[model samples]
Target chain A: MQEELFTSGRNIPNIDPYLDVWHWPIALYLFLGGLAAGILFFAALFYILGKDEVYPGAVKKATVIPPIALSVGLLALIYDLTHPLYAWQLYTTFRIESPMSWGAWVLLIVTPIAFLWTFSYYREAFGGIESKLKLFNKLKFLNTFEAWVIKNRMNMAYALIPLSLILGVYTGILLSAFNARPLWNNAILGPLFLVSGLSTGAAAIIIMSKSMKEKHLFGKIDLGLIIVELALIAHMIMGYYAGSQVQLEAVELLVGGEFTLIFFGVVVLLGLLLPAFLEVGEIMGIKIPVIIPALLVIIGGLVFRFVMVEAGQLTRYLY
Target chain B: MRYAMVIDTKKCVGCSDCVVACQTENNVPEGFCRDWITEVVSGSYPNLELELRSERCNHCEEAPCVRCCPTGASHVVEGGIVLVNASECIGCGACIASCPYDARFQHPDGHVDKCTFCHHRLKKGQLPACVSVCPTKCMYFGDLDDPNSEVSQLLKDRKYKTLAPEAGTKPHVFYLI
Candidate 1:
């Protein structure tokens, strides 16, 4: 009765004692991917609605986050792959049910669009680049492509709306598809990641925008997205709470166990609630630095993915 | 025709002959195995129940690993044996995360690797390496579709349970308690 000890026979390195198949790289990839999706989404959405002038940050400024974020995110994904050189195999066939397949195809088609959309506005963003370098004028296609893109930019906006939504949600569905992991086994994860992406996207705009109206508008947008994300998180936790015994154990990782402090404190309190309250205060005439709330939301979004990926991998059906 | 395994947990001594046989037969690589043993001690010490069984890929009927595989790499073949086409696997670890069995590993050659139910042996009309090498004769493998098969008879007669039954993976591995 004093003590009891049990020896583990399930000893397989990298699998047996503790499952460590996915790590921080996967988490980082997911966060950056969602962020890029969000940035592309709002940028395209406002352009489609003819609010390009009213929300120049969404269309031109924050649009810059996509190309940079996508490149880094994709690199993280490639870095995680044990068969990094074989990544091109993903494009050979499309498994409609596979979220990774969807991710591959979507990124392939949308990544170029994100760059092209940004390039279309390069002249506006860097008005005198051609004059300063004198080499830009030699690439006549660049000017012709810019003019063509500028004309059909609305069509690109139309395409990005659906594609961005898929990319944003794809990050979450990627985890949820692993029904073997009880923590990531909920459908709510899709919308949760999507809303978090929107919030993070809006935060990017708020960080980069110089206009007071654009900053204020995005603060409100991030605030709204954070609310939706919190609600989704609640629904997800509640689903787990009311779900099977395995799912209860999955939620326990957040509520009463290893993930409690970070999930509630960092992701919820600091990432979502603190930033949310700050945004509300700003609306109520309390002046706050835009960087403060924006950075908090971005950091929260990043940590949320880490929590989900790390904790989800730890939750298994066999335990 | 579904091929399956039936292990008599009550007779298993946890000697790990199955683990070695699998490694040698399939060339499963160092520090890795296609099958292994698990021991559980439950209840008070005096009345404790000890259960030992060899475990491997369940070759699930509703295999999530196959479903989640992006490049059609992890797939089910004849007799419901799940196999990974190493060349096609991007090693995204989706199938790894999706498997309730924890049966797969990233091979050193940079591809997904797992138990193929001794597919090469089966093709030659031989028993799976682990089943044939079990010292206790506690392990049995055959086509469950045939009523005369030892696995079918044992499962029909013995009180057996599968691992993670709640997962609804429809696991083909059975442990006769």
Candidate 2:
């Protein structure tokens, strides 16, 4: 085994054997974008479904936050790049084989779509010229046109739902491409990210909606989404446990290694459980307001990102 | 043309002469280094084996630092030497994070900095500072494309390997275990 290891022609002279260097930035981009994509996906879904009645004013008010978060998230990603100004080159020189390149394109497309969807909705409610015309203007020549053929505000927003979901899942899949990093190289990461994104996005929307007094629209959705998120978290944990020993050790690092405190305390208990408990209380006719739990969930979600990004890098790849 | 380095671990004495030479040759700032040596000590006190790797920019053919750079400051030179255009850098630390080997640093001036393989010296037909100063003759640098070059001959005659070849960076540096 020792001879094979040395004779494999895989060692670098005077260079420490380490995992791929691009892992840190790529991981960070995946985490932040996944969260943003997850939030936007849910927001767009609820809006297009006309389920705003369940959450009331909250959904409408909270709609603005996703784009803002996504934009900020993108900035952080670009900030991680050595040459941030060359970010636009991703579109110009697209590489089909590179997941980062794919992510760049997805972010580019989703960012604009999300912005337009939010803007159109805002214009409609606030009585902007474009919004008023869109809402009230009649096209005499286009009366015979099929309703589905014409682009409408709600239709535009509906278009974003699938794209946003892809963006969310793409984050996970991006990391999975790194077969070198045993911790990150898993088929389950994609779905795990998808589920986590939904939960985190829903939590962010709920909290932001409360601050904006759009609680009517945000309240019920928050509870439902939180419950769904908890289930997903459970499944992810179970899946992580059932994988290879290397993966299991990686999971243990999250659950019991250096990252245990943040993972268990902040992510699991405070982020997932407390919010879930609050949602249960609300559903059961208890008077417990969700603001506290919502805040905790958000903090937990962010900490979860921090922990995942940092912990994944801590372990040295032995193979 | 692909230029490369081959370092034999057996001859390295864990002395940091190469590190000092690289720093001095480049006028590298205090508290920041373009190249350094990392010592890995395994086993207990008595039976420990010390492995020393002199690390710098790998000047990878598919360098991620160049790909992730937002400013075009990080790039590959003619001889496949990865370099940073310090003047064009904005100190964003993107390269630092993107580098798998942690080879880059954001200098005090907020520019991305890393080993250039001493382009100026290479242009004048001289070896890199670290390669020229190694007392044990552990480090060798030459053009890989030229079969007559020392590095090419060594690569063909002996077993050598690169770090993280799976990354597809295609680093020019090789290690003889």
Candidate 3:
């Protein structure tokens, strides 16, 4: 029998795994990106599918989210990078195999399109607010572009739907492409994130909707998206359980190990199930406060991304 | 030519000489390492067996870090040694997440760092710092394509194993029992 070469005692230290490369900046970026994508997707879809009169100001308010959320998310992403000043390197070339490359291109394309889409709501953006300021008279050149935007607004909104969907899916794929982390490597992550994005997007719209019917429409859609998100969560766990030893370890980390409390207690109970219950109660003609479920859904969506991004890194194949 | 490494686990003393040598040679930042020793203990308490194994980047042919790199910073250079271009690295940590071995770490200066198989030494016709500094002569490095190379000769004679063969990354580093 050989003696222990280096016992974990006073002499030798145990090396902990390096699993915290990503932090809140990343989590915020993931949440905001998905939120922005979802908002634009539904706004464009509503513009194309439903009667314009049914939701007069819904699309315009929703359009506001993508530009603000995405710009902030991009800032968060850039700030999180080790080389914030050298971020231009990501745009210099495209690697079809790299998800980050796809993400960079998607963001670049979406930024201009989102800015254009915002112009479609020129009346909403600069309606009476612009005229009150002396600067509006100085910038009379904006009137021509605003008219053109209003004329082709429908066509522009239609073009935004697919781009929004791509952005939502790209957020998930960014993590999924890391095959080393089993928790983030599942193929279902793409749709799971897309559905979560839609749910949060719907919740955002519901919070800002002017009409009862518009609120109800987005509320019902959010409920459906929440159901799919929950189903995907279950599928993701089951798949991990039935997967390789490394994958099973990942599930253990989430289900019973370090991340157990947060994953189950916060993400599932507080974030998902509670909002779902409230949504169900509202559907059943109960006087459930719309803000309650809407807030819960948004909180849940953010927590879900936080837990996954942080806990997923804790599950390593080499440890 | 495909570069390779062969480490005889039986001969390792777990003194961390290779670790210190690599750090000194590569100037690896404090509190981080490009290579380290893992102590594996097995058998019942009364019939215990202990082994010390040196671990580092396997530099796989199907390197996931290289694949997941957005800017092609992590690349395979001459003799299949995996190296990183610190200037091009965005420090996004994508490579850090994609590395199955956990061999990569985020350098405080902001780029992902890992074992490079000592390309600088190889260019100078010298062994890697870890290989040259091992007191037990357990670590061997050379091109596997040359039949006369020590690495190929060792592989020809020893019945060996690899860490996480199921990973399917086809790592170039081999272990001799």
Candidate 4:
């Protein structure tokens, strides 16, 4: 509105209507972190419930992904920081109220646990290599901690379940913490992001799952997550439309404004709906290309982050 | 001491002397500013009322930027003046995104920067650069807690409105209509 105001005098004020601080790197980091967390949550949950025996490939792929994705996500975050060299300062001090602090600590804890979980698959490989090479057999290794970790893995799996959930939800809290941005200031964002992350994580697992049953199970799980995400997004938009003046201004960015096309097209349609349709067809015994839907869901997840982060910046209370 | 500013929009003449003087006094980088002015137009056609307002950081009592800063780089110092510690700033842009007034900006040298209410002058027991340089003498600045302070007297003598009170920032700056 200030941009439309007709003032006779020179407008010397620096009227910044929207934020330009965050970019694609932040979105990339959010998606990667959420995806990593989702994978670990599924793997740990199934392992604790004794369901992992039926889907060994899915469990293995899921365990390996969390650490790799988290490492790459952390790199993106560090790259986005203006003072990348001073990143150690984040770990030096902690702020209870800052969501960034929570995120840094959560990632620090989850990364090591996820990496250790992947080592379960390495035992077989190490055994095979030692059998072929007599030198490796003579080179004794410290097995006490590894044996203890293996023996208490079920307890560790239980601990990782909640940490993984926190990792997924913390990424959403990062945006929701900014009360100034109305698009992101909602209670539902935590659940919405959690579901989205899980959906994408399921899709990633589906691509790598060796058994047909495991692939089908993940496909169904992804479908459920997509449905919940759609409902949450609808609620988020409706709540904003019914909110105060500034909130309406924030919603205007999504409804029919600059972000309308991308939000509806990439995020809702291709990302959620089409994938849902394809997955349903697969469940009904109608042959659908597996890679097509999996890649679409992953791409859709990335686009969702891009739209929310970019459009959230465009919605502001001040001009 | 709760230092504050009261700008009288009725007396302002739209001259940008305050802006120039503030840049000079603070050595604000080129393409950046610590203080500036805004022109507001109300009504339509012949009944239009044009008002020139000197605008800067409100130095809010509950600054969202300070609350969101991960490293406490954006902080409130003596006199309740919210200032950024340049050395500690990570330039993560969290403060910039949290400010409802859009008062903060990332400097080219990689730190958040905004109006300090001329804290340097306050140390010398002098008025702020903008308040001192306004040709029309429309801006008033002083310790709001002191009964005899110019800002307190001006606030008591005139009716005023703060920008975006609904924002719940409790801004230290006021506008005398």
Candidate 5:
């Protein structure tokens, strides 16, 4: 036996120290990015699908807000990095195999497209002469030349949907890659993140539109989207409970373990349930302000990230 | 070549001599460790058997930490030892998140840190600090490719195992139960 290779010796004592120094900034970044991605993707979907009738002024307003929110989200992501200056390296040195590498590329691609789409809307708001310049005029295509660009670029944008879905889902898949920590290791994490991204994105757009007082033509569509979000969340929770015993124990950590209260009370109830109830109320002829549910849903989305990121880290790998 | 460490749990006495030796040799930061041990006690108190495992970067052939690093700061060296360039590390903690074994830590200088299998010592034809100071001689280090090397011989002769073989990391570190 290989055990014969060594002579006997004394044992060492163990120390299990908690390393919880990081907070806020990391959590904030995850929340902001999820919101930004969610909002931008939804807006693009509405514009491409010609679903304007379902949510009148929503696409226009949504197109304007996502770029700014995305810029803020990008800043938050850079801020959370240990070395923010090296962020440029993500663009310069790209690796197709790594998800971080892929995310960096996706951000690079999405950021400019989002900005151009947003700028197209303000070309008229900001004045016309400047909009005539080649660059500005090209950007104005999204608003003025929508038919030509969409006819030519529609396939390109359609290609972006799957890519965008990958970008949204990559965040959760990143966490699940750590197989040692049973809590984060699940095949379902990818879909869960994708759904959550859509939910958070819709919530962000709803909140922004209400705040700006842009005509809430999209209220019914927003309500419909939120209802879909609720269904996805329910599926995720049920899957979390019925999966592997080891994973179920890990889920217990979120449902009632160390993170139980926050996960159930803040994320599940306030974040998801309250927002869901508000949407239902709107559908049933009650006028619960849309902002109230939007805020709650956004908070819930942030809390979901907090719980997943922290809880995944907290669980130990027992071999 | 894939460099690896074979640990015989039966021979380990749970003494932390390897831990301290590794720290001093590497000049690891305060309150942070590149290598440590975990003890899992099973069964009732009266019949409990203490299992001790020394943990460190597995120097996986398909290392996830290196893949996750945004700056190319964390990477696998020539010998398959996963090394981090402290100067380049932004301490983004992404590598820390990627490691399945939880073998990484953030240094005070705001860089990701972990065991490098004592790269400097290896270059000088010496054993790693942990392997050199292991009092019970529980740790064995060598090139996995060389059939005559101590590690390869051990693999050939013993029914050894590795942590999370299902992870497909092809970790260089192995255990002899």
Candidate 6:
């Protein structure tokens, strides 16, 4: 065995092996937020480029998910905060350097836009369906608001594109900004999270959409994102491999250490690669059930966040 | 007036006087501490060297904890001492993760807490409780800006090192090995 040293500060909360300051709630929140960002980015991109005509499911129908996802995500975020009552202080001032500050503001802006985008498709999405809830059907202000949103939908698209990109990248940067965790100290995490989010968003559309054409289209899109995700993961691992002693130990935690099985066996193998191959088979007309690959992709996205957040905490500069 | 700390590792016997002294003086809660001892062993089995360090906040000149606080809770005051504004902190733990030294801790009261270098004691021209009670008198505290200060003199005369120097944090705590 190599040289071993021990300490007496075993009762401390977030030191060494006990380092779990951020937990499953933060992981789940990041996953849902990234997924929401992915859905919004694509929904906006398809509309601005006039591809909404060809991909109505991706453009309009998928917009329904973000508002709900964002609300749930925010609840989880609030639940995770130790001093959640003080969270309002995030809005009183703005610091350009703080990623959390950037995230707080971006989420505040995007959640409303996500609702507005979905509402613009109100007549098209929920027109003929009869509802027992007479209150929703009777709101005169809602009808006027919907009309206004429809008219401004194009302008909203311009704002959504950049905001969604920042939201997606912000989830990853939130972790990367913590230079103390050697595993999350890489720059590629931003692009990696963005691509992973898009893949999961595409999967959500494929599962939710009834049209065979929409399912096939998103399958192909997800395949491309999976490729990019794999490349980024490889590049990030290489960067860690080539880094200093601390980084080497950090990578070892993923490669052959405690996280090897869950990160590789579950996230990389089950979450990413398996779903990607299943999608490819679907694209080749192998008649795979639409839900299997798509659901796998979604599960993969959630597990990916768990792996990153947990593993990053296990890594540190000192022993 | 940049305050700095210098602890002579050779003279330290790992007695943990600093830990107990800081706790009582600061009224730190049970199962929590502002500073603790760390024992590091490096090199292979046959050629090993052990070092004991009484570690606490680095009080970095380029503090990431100050930068990452969503609210202006964690800030650097005069003398390059990084401190948390307990009333303002959201206890989001971003500053906790940002620290390379793992110095900051969330108090049971829902705000972050760490070694303040006894800022209150210093205000009365008194030494920090830990430094005052150290049996070996190995711990030194003074303004690094003044060339005549003990911390400045010890750093000049001896070969010393700071923890996690690669972080670019420019830590004020020095270890005279």
TM-score of each: 0.96, 0.71, 0.93, 0.92, 0.82, 0.96
Candidate 5 C-alpha lDDT tens digits along A142-238 = 4556454445444545655766677777777766666655677776777667767677777666765633333243345555656666676666667
Candidate 4, superposed: residue stretches over 4 Å from native: A1-17, A124-145
RMSD of 2: 7.4
Off by over 4 Å in 2: A1-36, A46-59, A71-115, A123-151, A170-191, A204-253, A277-293, A312-319, B41-50, B61-80, B85-95, B145-148, B156-171
Ranking by lDDT: 1, 6, 3, 4, 5, 2
Clashes of 4: 0
Candidate with top lDDT is 1
Two-chain DockQ for each candidate model? 0.59, 0.09, 0.49, 0.46, 0.31, 0.64
Error of 2 at A304 (Å): 1.4
* lDDT, candidate 1, at B136: 89
Q: What does candidate 6's lDDT look like per residue over B64-170, in tens digits? A: 99999998888888888888888788888899899898888888888899999999999999999999999999899999999999898899999999999998889
lDDT of each: 0.88, 0.66, 0.82, 0.81, 0.69, 0.88
Candidate 4 at residue A141, lDDT? 57
What interface RMSD do all candidates show, one decimal each? 3.6, 9.2, 5.1, 4.2, 7.7, 2.0
Q: Give the i-RMS of model 3 in Å.
A: 5.1
Runs of candidate 6 exceeding 4 Å displacement: A1-10, A128-130, B42-48
The candidate that achieves the highest TM-score relative to the unseen native structure: 1
Clashing pairs in 6: none
Residue A260 displacement in candidate 6 (angstroms)? 1.6
Candidate 2 CAPRI grade:
incorrect
Alpha carbon lDDT of residue B99, candidate 6? 89
lDDT of 2 by residue, B48-124 (tens): 77566676678888887777554466777798888877666655444554555656765555466778888999899
Q: What is candidate 6's fraction of native contacts? A: 0.61
Model 3 chain A is weakest, by summed lDDT over 10 consecutive residues, at A6-15
RMSD of each: 2.0, 7.4, 2.8, 3.1, 5.8, 1.8
Compute the lDDT of residue A59 as modeled in candidate 5.
54
